[model samples]
Target: MVRYLAGFPTPFASPANAIPANYAPNYQYLANPSEAGSLIWTLNMELTPIYAIAPEGPYANLIYDRLINALAGQLLQRPIPENFAGGINGDAYQQARTTFSNNFVSRVSIPGYLTGKTVTLFSGQVVPVITPQLRGLYAWHTEILVENAIATAPEEDIARLTDALTGFLDRIFFDLRNFGTSSADRALNYAATNAFQTASVLRQATGQGMQLDTIDVDRSPFCRMDSDCWDVRITFFDPENNRRARRVYRFTIDVSDAMPVTVGDVRSWPIS
Candidate 1:
């Protein structure tokens, strides 16, 4: 998910007066500064839930049953007197034999059966029962938070925030470049150039491309250690392909050194 915060624009004086006699101003500016253009964007996101399972039972009993079954087939040895008989020789064995015989007699002999004339008949039947239980192991919830700062005029706070976001984007692009291509610096350049071309083509397709006349970059005033700035101009072809219309976009980015760089050319041009 992604969210965007439209920030206030920055206003400044025109540098047209600084142009030399042979140079021309790229865009006209008011003698007095006004609010910069508005930043517009839309935010979108989604939420999803995660689920897990758990089990419940008497773990100790289960372990004991498993252990007994596993060792049941093992052999055991005990010493006995050499002349000992198989059964009924010792008092302990006799007692044990008597107890077993009594248990068997109790199961087979019914009381009051001596009354021969009357007999009772019994039918055996068994009923089965089943029970099941379910438990929830874990539950999950997702949330999305979005914030926006809309300014009627250019503000320092907006610039700071935008600068921070641009830095983040630069790192992301750098890493993407490294993974997708091979060189990070080249990747950054490719992305920048592509952005310019895409904007140019989109505007041209919409009839606004003709309004663009030229594009350039200004490396001065951009902090080398913290920020990157670029000046882009979009130019429109004239009817005679001589005269042109143009617009400029000044972009600044902040990034870190840990980002990966991409390699190779990323330009895609239409075949004419």
Candidate 2:
């Protein structure tokens, strides 16, 4: 079995010298299926490749199809270069870039298991290989994530909620970034994506003038026999009177199997 890992699904031109000397500047060429074989897929964090992806098993083709779809989507959103060989005009190109820029574009999330094998690229860099799990694969944009919960919030409240949610996500992606090898890290990584419950709790907390205080993961005492579990606790407190009012929400995650799952309902309590 491979180690579990999560990161951005980034596509790259494999070899440093893969680009042809006379390659045309046309973007349409990228959408051609024939060109797909030359691209290398990788799971990246902070724009650094952590693992090179090599899809295996029955889902390989499906994974490839999804990746190609992401590429096609990005290309469709990109503005054509002004002097490109393609006959696309200036107005259409500008409009495409403007729309893409104004909106919060979604990025593909590839979370799965590593094959415990290493592969060397043409550039002599070696990276562990990962086979993505189709179950957790998704495309997400941060604002789109919490928009439904805060739909009717006042304009000022909406901004605060978005900040709280994104701050939680950014802290995980940057501050607590890890390989997802340990039971705790896996639970935390999974929590970062499946955060709708957290958002809901945050809405309730913020209404009472609470702010996110801390996030912690530890061994779960409530685990079933023969199962490995961890409890992820998200705490909130009143900024004005930090010592007097606080709340803690906890959810248990079982990671004994290849895919981790929530054990039961999210439990919460007060901490004064």
Candidate 3:
């Protein structure tokens, strides 16, 4: 049912930009939980709600451009915990909200949303407020909070974005290590491009096929195998014929000399 509704793609900003490019809340909080639940839950990206009410199409983006420009200096930075109720400035943000409300109803792909819709957002729960028109329902807002916590001296938001990607890369590499079976091939699947010192044992997919379930990154000191690395969940097809067989791989990457994790070209394995 929710699938019938549209989702606004979260926007991303360049690292070099001095001010946030979007009015969407500008910071991210990656959780390093004390316990491991499932994969997706562990890898969620935190957010402070970014409230906007607009119609889609030419006007949707235009309104955001206006709004961001309206709050130029305040665009990007860490979200204040107290501001979870919504934007910090009542007058300014309310103005932007009103601007969206007044303008969108008549625009192309406009949402039938009420004048003052309350939009709530969290890590995995950014829902769109929309009503279907003859043209079908469409997303109303796309203004992503480009991350609010910014400092001229702090680690750039772009770096956090990079960390987000690399962290996932680390997860993928973490998964690929146990990708295949040993009887199928005693050899491991450690690619030359992988930065981890531990050569992951790769295996072959036998019996039942397996799904590349989910990638979970462990950020806490107790759960993580390394002091400052990851305890990642990886899956593989095993001799038991289970479709969801998995393993946990751990590696600590030194930040001072860290390199981007790269996935190598897939090649035919040496059959045992």
Candidate 4:
């Protein structure tokens, strides 16, 4: 992740448009409240995909190109060139963009899919208002994981239970995600958990509402250490208006069919 630091007129000055099929966060100021300078805004251009994409797809370069162009726009923004009239800032931005563009055009690894770091790009501005440097070109090691829940009952019975529970959760999050008001007893997933008196983010989401994407069984690869665990993720969202508000309901159930059953806790993972 590139940490860009700039003092803008308003937080809204930075463009909010982004690359497609990727996750983009809102322009936010520095984490420290006291250290937040005037109109400090950050633009996190994430290149990773929400779903899998082949390396050389037809639309692969579309987002990458747009991102480079956006960076060029930022580079050409005022305070930068004014401070670096000697020409170092322009040269560095062009070089980084060139390297990124070359890798992109050659069908090499897309820079967007790589892991990002939370760096302080402009530690202390000196001659130039802001100093931007490209870092990290490490090979990515993505883990493919999927876990299946243990079924003590017959296949038909398990399917019915999963379906019923899925519907119950869909309705539950409708209220929780929207109003931020839910009791432990009212939630089916939370009730299933051994020790959730419902004091969790699971019951604390603030948004209009979220749609239920999928509640089916997951069969992805699993961690050997957690072989006894059953995994289910509930994906939901208000796609058009709040893509960043996409959420997931994740839970690990201990295979009850085994000698000792272990059912884990309930939680929510915000994909946005």
Residue-level lDDT tens digits of model 2 in 1-272: 01011122222333332222222112343345444445667666666777887777787767766665554443332333442222255454445444544332355567777789987766787889888877667655555666765676788788877878788888787788888878899889888877676677677778788888889999998789999999999899888985766899899999887678889998889987
Predicted candidate 3 versus true structure: per-residue lDDT over 108-206, tens digit per residue: 122133334444443555533432122212222211211221112145334544333334345543444331222111112222123122222221221
Q: How many clashes show up in model 1?
A: 19
Order of models, best lDDT first = 2, 4, 3, 1
TM-score of each: 0.20, 0.73, 0.19, 0.24
Identify the candidate with maximal TM-score: 2
lDDT of 4 at 49: 19
CA lDDT, every model vs. true structure = 0.25, 0.67, 0.29, 0.33
63-138 per-residue lDDT for model 4 (tens digits): 3333333433333222222222234455543453344332222111112231232323354421212212122111
Local error of candidate 2 at residue 124 (angstroms): 3.3
Ranking by TM-score: 2, 4, 1, 3
Question: Candidate 1: where are CA atoms >4 Å away?
Answer: 1-197, 204-206, 209-215, 220-225, 232-241, 254-272
Where does the lowest 10-residue lDDT sum fall in candidate 1? 105-114
CA lDDT, candidate 2, residue 137: 72
Local accuracy of candidate 1 as per-residue lDDT tens digits, 125-215? 2211111112111111100000121132135444443333333334333433221122223234433433333332433323432322333
Candidates 1 and 3 compared by lDDT, better number: 3
What TM-score does model 4 achieve against the real structure? 0.24
Query: What TM-score does structure 3 among the candidates reach?
Result: 0.19
**Global CA lDDT computed for model 2:** 0.67
